[model samples]
Target: MKHLASNLYYLRTRNGYTQEELANHLFLTHQTISNHETGKTEPDFSIIQKYADFYHISAEDLLLNDLSKKEKNSRIIFDSVIFDKRDKVFIIISGTKGTYSYKNIKKCEILNEKARYKGKEEPFTHQVVTGVDWLVQANILEQPFYVGLRLTMKDGTHLAIYTSKQPTRTQTDFHIRDVKEAEKIKELIDKIIMKYKNDESYKMDNVNSKNIFFDKDRQTFQILSGSKGIYPMKDVCKCQIVFEDAKYYGKTKPFSHRLLISSFESFFVTLRDTYVGLEIELKNKEKLYVYVSNIKQKHHSDAFKADVKVAETLKKYFKTIITGNKTMKDE
Candidate 1:
């Protein structure tokens, strides 16, 4: 409030906007802009919010905060907007035939959480918590300029956070108006990530001596069992983890899913799953199914399955990186 006039003039000039241009952008007359800058008048709270949003700063900071201090951080709250939790996030993937799609989260789940947090945290955060389960339970392992997360359900269903590079397209948006605040938020996030990592249940991943680890440098998913090759994640169409009576494969077994890579026409195994099946549509429009069961073929060839993790990772990487279909795809 103390620097309202000064801040307005400074920000206008700093952004290379004339008083007339700024007024036009704000749908106001130049005289009004001049009046505000000259301290003859003040903008209403709504107009103040618009100015803050245009400048990518917080309204609170724009009104009452001093920004000239030589502080250690300059992080600014860019934006924060309310989102309706009851609404469903729709995914539309079109093929030559039509489309394959599903809601990102079930409505019942959102309603339950919404009711649970009626007077508590933001309703939208509940969806984030459900998808990125670690957010509420873990400490930050790392924070980057841009981050993406994949949340896989028990039945191979999954969701991706910010699958597209565009921030406007993402589900959640929040900004801190100061660098020090950003650092503090990062510290808090790191603590949450660490909490999840420390959880005993977090250790149950399908990794072992025989498991093929995803190689970041090579951009491939490869585990050497009887094979000596790496597989790129992009080409995978689908994957599955099969199951049989008492014997389970790929960590817990029946809960797993299989993967099919479009470019990898030949059948191969990159990791150890109970049963691995690749479904490919031939150029002739014929469907081919290749099944691999464990290190040995004896158990049940048709029963190759994929776990939620493997299926989710492969499918997500395929859709986001390879297919380039985050929102909608036209065949």
Candidate 2:
């Protein structure tokens, strides 16, 4: 076999180190270093690794002369480390999440595909397939980066490749409206009630429920529910009236609704003002509106104007509104 003794001798001389000095640095006997330089004996792998580290050269370079065809093939094994199927996909996960979350796909793609061959195919898919194939050919599924592939193909159909295991979840923190925003909503509700007070045509029942819709961008609120059911502030007083079907009211009798505000920071109110009995629904914990009487009332233009004004006043204070049955958190 060829030997690297000449190359070793050259490197030692080039670095201004004698045989004894090189031996001392490598923790080998001076005679062993002399034998290595003269090609009398080959050094063990541990010594070769140490020599590579000491000279800042690769083991492959130091042992290149001594490597036979079989040895050369062995070097190929080191070209790429074998990884499992699961490990291959784990690499793909980095680029996907980085692209989606940070909007940094350009950087991620460049870094990830550096060692990969250039092609027109999707860069991530190519990296994944290459990794998988490398693992499979080397029979290294048990290795740390190993992954399995189930591929299907037939005439006149696109190929299908399936991967196992879901990607890991990425955690993120988001800011939410604070208690101050909640207080602002409450203040807006109060203003709407005050603005519509004492209008006979307004149909303010003993149980009056108010729904506040919040405009987050504008930092304001709008009233959503009323005797006419649900109406926007802009249409509250105009000729544009969108009537709500009286489904909450039962058939054939007078109904009375009751509003119940709970101490748990939630609201419940019931709608019962037609043929149905008293049914309750929650408006808000601090405030609620319920229809308490079955008195039939007519809609007046002035009353409509008053309702619109109340909604307009409230619109300056709240953000996003939801109306539905309320349930206590612990309950």
Candidate 3:
């Protein structure tokens, strides 16, 4: 802690604040600020932590490094914060949202909405794995400068990490202290997302080649069969996966088939003929329908039907994604 007193003096003076002002910000008496800067009194661990947090640098770095040197304190935010993981490229930037690898991640986007870190006032929030791909950058412009990035995992656990500390929830949005740095981070993340998201290796295989994929976390349905299309999960007012194996038209008969879907358990569905469609009703009252016409199954009579109960877990997962109201039975 040899450099602690000098560092404290430099930080306060560098910010152009009087001892009393710094004291007020830290909720301490002016004498404590003076004593610490003068090296008359040393702060304990808890007080040291407060100082490190206020300055937005790691406590260890503040303690060991000579921050008063121009190059020492002039750290590039990304260089100091980001570290590579494994043989893969550097993807996740550790912050309030915790470090996460891009591959395991479902999406990341800018969220301009200002709110308390769903956890604490500090910037560090959830997540700590690191990997790549897919980003949904949202620039919410309620005001001039309250921007944040909403990073979500595949499992639906999400968090919005803003650049600097914001006021408590009751007030309107305001500019965060390090907004410019935050924006650069956002752009950097977006670039990484674009690079890996389209790579053939990162995406999951299509659903039976129907060109449709369901994002369980986002609760949204996408159809990439022809052109790209997206629909929010809540917009899905109707859904059914029907099985159709046989159809008799006046003079012809269709054979029966078994459809097998691998999940937590393997099971088969036998249907003479079935139709599966997902319907969406948009805010503009427009209707969109996506039908699964790719499944073709025919099987012998000896094939056994799957246990319908096995679908319950998946059912609940999807239900949590869509289903707006409390409904008849609560999940």
lDDT of each: 0.39, 0.33, 0.47
Candidate 1: worst-modelled 10 consecutive residues by lDDT? 91-100
User: What is the C-alpha RMSD, rounded to one decimal, of candidate 3?
Assistant: 20.8
Query: What is the TM-score of candidate 3?
Result: 0.27
Of candidates 3 and 1, the better by lDDT: 3
Clash count, predicted structure 3: 23
Worst 10 residues of 3 by lDDT: 128-137
Q: Identify the runs in model 2 with alpha carbons over 4 angstroms from their true place.
A: 65-331
Evaluated against the true structure, the overall lDDT of model 1 is 0.39
80-152, model 3: which lDDT tens digit per residue?
Answer: 1332222122222323423344434566664444333334543224321111211212222222223456666
Writing each residue's lDDT as its tens digit, candidate 1 over 181-256 gives 3244344333323322332232325333244455433345553532334655434443333322223433442323
Candidate 2 vs 3: which has more TM-score = 3
